[model samples]
Target: MAERSIIIIGAGMAGLSAGCYARMNGYKTRIFELHNLPGGLCTSWKRKGYTIDGCIHWLTGSSWGTLYRVYEELGAVQGRQMVDHEVFVRVESDGKTFIVYNDIDRLEQHMKELAPGDAGVIGEFCNALRVLAGREMPSDKPIELMGLVDKLRATKALSVLKAMHKYGRVSIQQFAARFTDPFMREVFPEAMANMPDLSISGLMMALAYGHGRNAGYPVGGSLEFSKAIERRYLGLGGEIRYKARVERVLVENNSAVGVRLADGTEHRADVVVSAADGRTTIFDMLGGRYVDDSIRRYYDKWPVYEGFLQVSLGVAHDFSAEPQSLAFRLDDPVQVGDQSRHWMQMRHFCYDPTMAPEGKSVVIATYAFTNPEYWNKLYADQEKYRAEKQALADAVIDRLDKRFPGFREKVEVVDVATPVTFERYTGNWKGSYMGWMATPATEGTWMKRTLPGLANFYMAGQWVFMGGGVPGAILSGRHAMQVICKKDGKKFRTSTP
Candidate 1:
């Protein structure tokens, strides 16, 4: 039998993973990326001798587990150092501060000390974290391929399921309302303000993962981790074409047969896989002919995660002693686009030496939920757009100076990336970092990789997975290959670096 040929769109983690697995299964594959690099949203850029990392806060399954195995197979974890954070987050409200420590016991005690009146709820929360920490979820196969034994093995997660059932219904906002203490109420909401509607179960899982030291930041950050997988795919004889923007998925007789590039060049293949933006792939590339009611509902009504306006600085002073992430209420609100932000979260990359010089650090502040259309329209006047970015940076720096007395004077470089910047670099719809917002309404909702009435095509990316992240995106690619392998009557295989 002739080897099936596959043309994959996008060189992001999902596309690269699909290529690697395809090569391992004796399939011919080629990947086309819009940018001149891999890693799509998982990317970084250089500024005045400093590397500004744009993605990867904390990677789940940084240590040994099913996810770790996938990382190892894709070469994402090979020869890479993982930095385990001692404190997950530091939140300040009014004049008081609280730290969420990696140690559950320590975190519980700290919360009790901070808000002794809310000790009961704090204990309940910590106990839930402990229960979740002891449980593990299987990731070896897609749901369609899970055998009876696999189903049986999942029974081990009953305790986790119970905990989730109890807490998953409550939003972080509602969960905060359970706290009687004023400080506890403010702390819970502020700590997870970026995902305000996240379930208490989701928060518990994150804390559990952190407590186990399973969630760690890669030493070199997002770009290096992506490049590692890129190298692995190339080593397995997979081909990649960078700066190759795909204009359309060439469909003949209602089947995906190939792809047409922006340059009017066409490449035919037996199968076409899109790891690109979901909206573009469905509406623009395929002409919206294959969508069903479910698809329409997803596109029309689903809550999408919002993009951010990021202000990054290369500071000459070391921040190694500071918490990795700090969220504080601002005395003076900063104007960002059409909205005014009264609070901000700052991420310090002092632990990653690769991001800056020995004595310096890379500090980033993310102003969440910035409107992409606002930036998109403003960018028509290039000078005005640039000025707005600079003004936001200046305001953030002034605010930082108040917190860290010498922050303003010690800054050597500044780089700002807005929602429009994300849209230009990555074709993500509305420049969302993640596709769907992971709230109670959308969590655990599985999107079918194969669209209704579409054939010989599949999608592998965050767009197809609810509450998408590095693990889910990479695994989604593997699941696509699994479906293909089953269809071809061949077992899916994986290769290690």
Candidate 2:
């Protein structure tokens, strides 16, 4: 039999993983990327010797878990050093401070000390973490592929199942309102990195992983991390083409056959897998021919993670002793385009020495905003866009100077990245870094990887899975490969190098 060849679109986390696994399963594969480099949103850039990271605050499964095997198979976790932080985040408002500790016991004590009135709810929260932290990670394989034994393993953890049932539907914002103390009420909503709409169940799982030292930051940044996986794919005899923008999925007889590039070049393959932007793949590339109502509802009604304004600074000052992340409310909100901001979170990459010079560190401030049209319009006017970027950076710098005192003088470089930058570079719709928002209703929801009427085609990445980011991206890729192997009457195979 001639080797079945597969063509993949978008060289992001999901695309790279699919290529690697396809090769492992004895299939020839090639990946086409829109950008000149890999990683897509999972990347970083250098400015004046400082590396400004755009992704990867912490990668879950860096140490060991069910998902760790997936990372190992994709060449993401091996030979990578993981740094576990003691504190998750330091949130401050009006001189009052709240720290979320990785250690659940210590966090419980601190929460009680800070807000004795809310101790009942505090115990409820801490106990959930304690229970989940002691539990083992679930299987990484797709649920449909699991055997009876695997299904039993998944359901045997009654405590974890009960915990999920108890708190699965509660949003962080809703839970924060249940606090009796005024301070707790005000700060709890923003505790999970200012993602108020995120399900509390999501936070519990992450904190649980962190408590076991299973989740941590890589010593290098996001780009280097993505490069590791790329190297793995190349080593597996997979081919990748940079600057190859896939414009359309060539379909014949209602089946995906190959792809046509922007420059009018066509490539034929036996199978096609897209890890590209969800909106473009369904509505544009496929010409809206293979979608049903479910697909339409997802695109129309689902809430995506809004695009944010990022201010990057390389400072001459050392911040080795400072917290990795700090979220504080400002008395006076700084104007950044059409949005007004009250809270700002500054993240300093002091733990990873590769980010900055010997005596300096890289600092990033992100302001979340929802008005995508405002940025889309501003970007059209080059002068207005440039001026807005500078203004946002200046306002962030000024605020930092007040908080840190003498901080402005230590700055050596200033850079800004907007929604326009992301949309232009990665082609993500609305500049959403993560494809979908991790909300109460969306948690654990799985969209069909194969569109209703499409054959020989599969979609992977954050779009297919409700929970976005690295975990969803890699899993979706693996699942696609598994489905393809099953269809070809071959067993799915994976090997760790």
Summarize candidate 1's per-residue lDDT along 123-184 as a digit string, tens digits. 98898899988457777788878899988888888788677767777789888898898888
Write the residue-wise lDDT of candidate 2 on 1-497 in tens digits: 99999999999999998999999999999999999988988999999899999998888887876678889888887888899989888889878988988899988999999999989999999999988885764646776688888878888677887787567778898889888888888887666767888788878888887888877998889999899999999999999999999999999999899999999999999999999999999999999999998899889988887676689999999988888889899988988787788888899999998999999989999866547779999888999889988988889999999889999999999999988788889888888888887687765566888898888999998888776788779878988999899889998898999
Candidate 1's displacement at residue 222, Å, is: 0.7
Cα error of candidate 1 at position 46, Å: 0.7
Top candidate when judged by lDDT against the true structure: 1
* Residue 156 displacement (Å), model 2: 2.8
| Residue 333, model 2: Cα distance from true site in angstroms | 0.9
What is the TM-score of each predicted model, taking all chains together? 0.98, 0.98
> Which RMSD values do the candidates have, in order?
1.2, 1.3
lDDT of each: 0.89, 0.87
**How many pairs collide in each candidate, listed in order?**
0, 0
